[model samples]
Target: MTMTMTMTIAGACPGFRARLLLGGALLAGSALAGPAVAQDMPAPQKDAAPGLTKVASFEHQVTGVTVSKDGRIFVNFPRWTEDTAVSVAELKDGTLTPFPDAEWNGWRNAKKDQVDARNHWVCVQSVVADPKGNLWVLDPAAPAMAAVVKDGPKLVEIDLKTNKPARTIAFDETVAPQVSYLNDVRFSPDGKTAYLTDSGASGALVVVDLDSGKARRLLDGDPTTMPDKSVTVSYDGKPLRRPDGRGVEFAADGLALSPDGKTLYWQAIKGKTLYSLPTDALTGWLTSAVVPSALTDKSLSGKVETVGENGPADGLIISRHDGRMYVTAPEENAVKVRDLTAKGGTPTVLVQDPRLRWPDTFAEAPDGTILFTTSHIQDSAFYKPDAPAALPTELWSIKPGAAEATGSTTAPK
Candidate 1:
């Protein structure tokens, strides 16, 4: 696995000595209360029972999931609202085992005990595997939205074989001091560049030069980058608002690089519009004067089509063989697909079940079966109640048939 560490943080661990990596930001508010309801998925498929084979499940709530090039599944659990012993694990031989033990996880959680700062691992927003087979773990470093600009907020890269870190990326007071909860990251097809989304308090795209190890935020709060206010996102049945009065807009959660590697598409959790830009325009290396002449009128750069108007939007993946884009729209209790090439047909509805309570991430297997996770988030203490849930959160899979494929094929990256 490839490990990356650029900016240095005082308490940050150099590598992955354990399974869990914890980050906490202290914001004022009462600590969230206890055991959430056992949330359940919607009813099974009606016709053929759209076979949903469970790959794995964890006792702690799972937020993000990803698969390595070799097909090994890596999952991360942020030590956020819940009291947790471990933060990350791997599914091997159909069983979940700690990829790294607690010592490593504890180091991730440690913070200054000074009266002004509180220590805790808030949550892990993204888990991604690079082309070189290294796993990149993004730790938002701040717990609960308390702004910790210095000695906090980092990205840790771990070697899958040794479970050790190759590098750590951090920011201090000189950099933007507010919380930079680094979210999803995607590698260029050539693997020469990496683009990360900052879904933190300051929403922006942080572009990193992999070869040079340089990083900076771009489209910083630009109109195209900000979230739209008209869209309301619900998890199960309730809207997901920050504990504070501010509504959760510009979540900047779901990210995808087009098959050609020229366009980067993104959507906010609280946004209804889908926006994209030429990769060259968002790198921050070019000033408006030097920006490509082709990069003008972002609204004309891409069109934002309406997906179902419900629930929060999370992970997104584009199929290599069929040119279809799959997204998780958890409010409607379903996983939806849009044919990128369709001229005017309605987007096909893939799976919409109550069981998919709060589906977060989406990954397509080599064979075209879509894999995703269900958090039952709307039913959780963070969003809803603390009682026995009627349904269980599960990992679900759906296989696409030959008819799903169009006449064209995606060129190899």
Candidate 2:
């Protein structure tokens, strides 16, 4: 298979397929997004790595980030430790604006009983700019990883041209149970289906048909999706845990699709091993006429291929520029690249800096710069009650191939 279609990580492995599942990626964008305004960047975290540049800093916990094909930059703030003012925003030329408008972001935790969580951005986890020129948002609607509000969980698609929601697919208790937190999503190249990861109490992959608006939750509680009990997440050279003695337990979080869309890979944030499966295996069962059964689910599970290890990662993306998979190595304060030329191999550090505290999510610009966020999970109130409710987080970028750091700019308004 060609590099465009397959990201073969190693030589021959136990389950490496002869005809690997791979697909095309999004169209390349034009230039590197402009830097955040100078005042927005605190001097302490500036130029923390060789080619790393600080783009923007936010008051709330910032998790997911995406660079649109036409060069628009968007980010998301999940209502994890505090009630976020704006759940999703656009970063343009130095200003960060509530995308679409403020009305969509007006939902508040204080007014949860009064407000309708169905239409508003409630605990948005990811913002993805699809190849079809639409921006999609995934909202688990479970604030602080707690109870899910009735009619809260949803996936929304907005047309970039009109800046209005084109369609929305709602997930009920069956698809997004109270314990599931839909984390991230990758759209198929054809724009017909979407794949997502549930990184909550029990882990699973949620597949949605864009046209039918039908969703199927697969691999629920499977070993590959759940957090590995043997793994321990540590930060600052110590095991990160709350006073009650809980280590990182997020499951099936980081997700990546092959450049060609034939392959899909994901791993748990509280676990290390990466796993992948052919898009065909997932979509094939989803579209079939027979009702979903345990036998069918087990058959699909057997098709999953172990893609080797990436120690405690949070986000993942296959770079359209170099065709290598980039992983957010949160525990290591680094970003890594898994060379796809090999069959099934290990990833090497691409960028590492102390400032990259929990490099959470990734989005590659057309110019090939990799932009990620430092969510600072270890410092959040969930782990440390003494921490400020409104946490300060920053957006960072890794210039392809270690170029001179782009000079800083003004902060977003």
lDDT of each: 0.55, 0.79
Highest TM-score: give the candidate number. 2
Q: How do the residues 1-413 of candidate 2 rate in per-residue lDDT, one tens digit apiece?
A: 11212221122112211111111111122223334221222233332555666666666688989977766778888989887667887764334567777778878788643478878888999999898868999999999989887898999998888999988899998789999899999999889989999999989998889999998888888889999999999998899999789888999999999978999999999898999999988898677886555213678789999889898999999988789898888888888889767867789877777777789999977677787888999999878979988787878777757533433222212
Please report the TM-score between candidate 1 and the true structure: 0.72
Q: Top model by lDDT, which number?
A: 2
Stretches off by above 4 angstroms in model 1 are: 1-51, 108-122, 145-150, 172-177, 235-247, 284-312, 342-346, 385-392, 402-413
Clashes of each: 29, 18
Per-model TM values vs. the true structure:
0.72, 0.86
Summarize candidate 1's per-residue lDDT along 1-413 as a digit string, tens digits: 11211222123233222211111110111111111101111222233225443444445567667666655566766644553444556644333445444345453334452221112233556677776778877666554335543554666677877877777665443223465566778877787677777665556666677766666666555544456667776553456665553455545678888777777777777766556667876654533444322113344334433333323477777776577777777666666777766443434556665556678777654445566877665665554445332223455556655213421112222
Candidate 1 differs from the real structure by a C-alpha RMSD in angstroms, to one decimal, of: 11.9
Q: Which residue runs does candidate 2 get wrong by more than 4 Å?
A: 1-47, 293-296, 403-413
